[model samples]
Target: MIVIYGIKQQLTPIKAELSDVIHQCMQEVLGFPEDKRAHRFIPMEKEDFYYPGGRSEAYTVIEINMMAGRKVETQKKLIYTLFERIEEKIGILPIDIEITIKEQQSYQWGFRGMTGDEVNDLKYKVNV
Candidate 1:
């Protein structure tokens, strides 16, 4: 799953496009399947969203959650791909985007009434 956070006024209009761009990057870098999209957007009001210096109101934070198996090089490629693709396709500059990948042991995730570690029918590989 991917959680995206940004100011409501700036993020509301581009949510779908942003999701598509992010999914494209994920598929390109991590070999994710076309049906594996899970994006959640958190659009906050300006008063509730505080950001670091030098970033504009368009600043966005993307947090990717997944199983801990991908190689470091693969993860880095995904980050770089996201930065490039988001900037090119969504018009959000690299400086305005912050991305973080959070990985956990498969046993820690639960879905389809089963833990991730027990799932044997995944359409995508996680150890890439």
Candidate 2:
């Protein structure tokens, strides 16, 4: 799953493009399927969305959650791919975007009404 946060005016209009870019990056770097897209956009007010200096209102934060086991190189590739694709395809500068990947043990995840470890049928491998 991916969670995106940005100011409403700058973020709402590009939700579709952002989701496409994110899923595309995931497919390329993470080997995810085209149909496996889970994205959440949180559009906040200007006053609510505080950002760091030197960045415009375009500043966005993306948080990706997944099961652990991917190599460091793979994770780095995902980040770089997202930055490049988002900037080129969504018109969001890499400098104005922040991305973080949060990984947890498979056993800790619950899906399909079962714990990750108990749910054995998965379309993709987690240990990439």
Candidate 3:
């Protein structure tokens, strides 16, 4: 599963399409349907926060936190794919995006009110 949190200004024209674009990117990278994943998008107006070091011109900043039953290489590839898609869709160069991967034990995550082992077994039977 992937959770994406973004902070950007309201004046940016991409606000309307951000969530859709993110969903598409995740689907393409992870090869999974929306129902099997968890995603989060957070938007902030310009005045609500300050970008230090004169970096205010950036229209979007993406932070992705993901948990998957995949190897490191697979995780890296997924992240790269996401970045490529984001750049293509938003017309932004690959500069301000960040991604983090966390591997969790089967008992660590809860989905649909089911804890780690149950969800893992469910997804494994369905996907693996």
Candidate 4:
């Protein structure tokens, strides 16, 4: 699963479009197959966010966290695709985006009270 959180000053006509653009980039990067991609958007006010040494003028930061299933080639492709989309949609010539990937075993994550075993078994049973 891939999770995305977009933080920008209160949503405006333009900023709102940015949120959608970011989400689309994420979905494409993860190869969501037109479905099964989950994401969340967290918007903040300009005054409420502090970038430290980062600038706020038409700048954005994108962070991605996911398991190691995706190949390095796929990861690079996703990042490039995201930057291309951002440039096209937001018109921000110089934007900053960062992504991080990690490897996680299936047992480490669970849904409801079931672990990976139960979920995989259920899917296998259904397919059979």
Candidate 5:
């Protein structure tokens, strides 16, 4: 799952485009399937969303949660790909985008009434 946070005005209008670019980066870098897109957007008010210096109202934080298995190089590639693709396709510069990947053991994830490790029918590989 991917969670995106940004100021309401600067984020809402581009959610669809951002989601598509993100999913495309995921597919290109991690070999994720098209059907695996899961993005959640949180558009907050200006006062509610506080950001660091040098970033504009367009600053976005993207948090990616997934099962732990991918190699470090693969993860870095995903991050770089997202930064490049988002800037090129969605007009969000790398400096204004913050991305983090949080990975956990497969057993820690529960879906489809079963734990991730027990669900053997996944269409995509996690250990890329």
Candidate 6:
């Protein structure tokens, strides 16, 4: 799953486009399947969302959750891909984008009433 957080004023108008951009990056760099999109948007008020210096209201936080199997290089590619694609396609600058990938062992991931390792078929590669 990918969770996105940003000020409502900035993210509300472009949520769908931002989701598409993020998914494009994931599919290109992480080999995510087209049908496996899990995205959550958390749009907060200005008072509820605080950012650091040099970042405007466009600041966004993207948290990616997944099983731990992909190589470091692959993960790096995904981050850079998101940064580039989001800036190019969504008009969000790199400085305003904060992305973090949270990975756990396959045994820790529960889906389809079973853990990731217990699943028999996956449409995409986890080790990519």
Backbone Cα, N, C clashes tallied per candidate: 0, 0, 0, 0, 0, 0
Candidate 4 overall lDDT versus native:
0.54
Which stretches in model 1 have alpha-carbon errors above 4 Å?
A: none
lDDT of 5 by residue, 38-116 (tens): 8999999999999999998899999999999999999999999999999999888999999999999999999999999
**lDDT of each structure?**
0.97, 0.91, 0.58, 0.54, 0.94, 0.93
Q: Write model 2 residue lDDT over 17-105, tens digit each, in one string.
A: 88988998888888898878989999999999999999999999999999999999999999999899998988889899999999999
TM-score head-to-head 3 vs 6, winner: 6
RMSD of each: 0.5, 0.8, 3.6, 5.2, 0.6, 0.7
Worst 10 residues of 4 by lDDT: 119-128
Between prediction 1 and prediction 4, which has the larger lDDT? Answer: 1
Query: Compared with the true structure, what per-residue lDDT tens digits does model 4 show for residues 1-128?
Result: 44433345433435556657756765556544444444444556666555536644444555565444667777777778777876787765444444454556556667668765445533111110
Ranking by lDDT: 1, 5, 6, 2, 3, 4
Whole-structure CA lDDT of model 3: 0.58
TM-score for each model: 0.99, 0.97, 0.68, 0.63, 0.98, 0.98
lDDT, residue 126, candidate 4? 13
Q: Where is the poorest 10-residue window by lDDT in model 1?
A: 23-32
TM value for model 1: 0.99
Q: Look at candidate 4 and give me any clashing residue pairs.
A: none
- Better structure of 3 and 5 per TM-score: 5
**Candidate with better lDDT, 4 vs 5:** 5
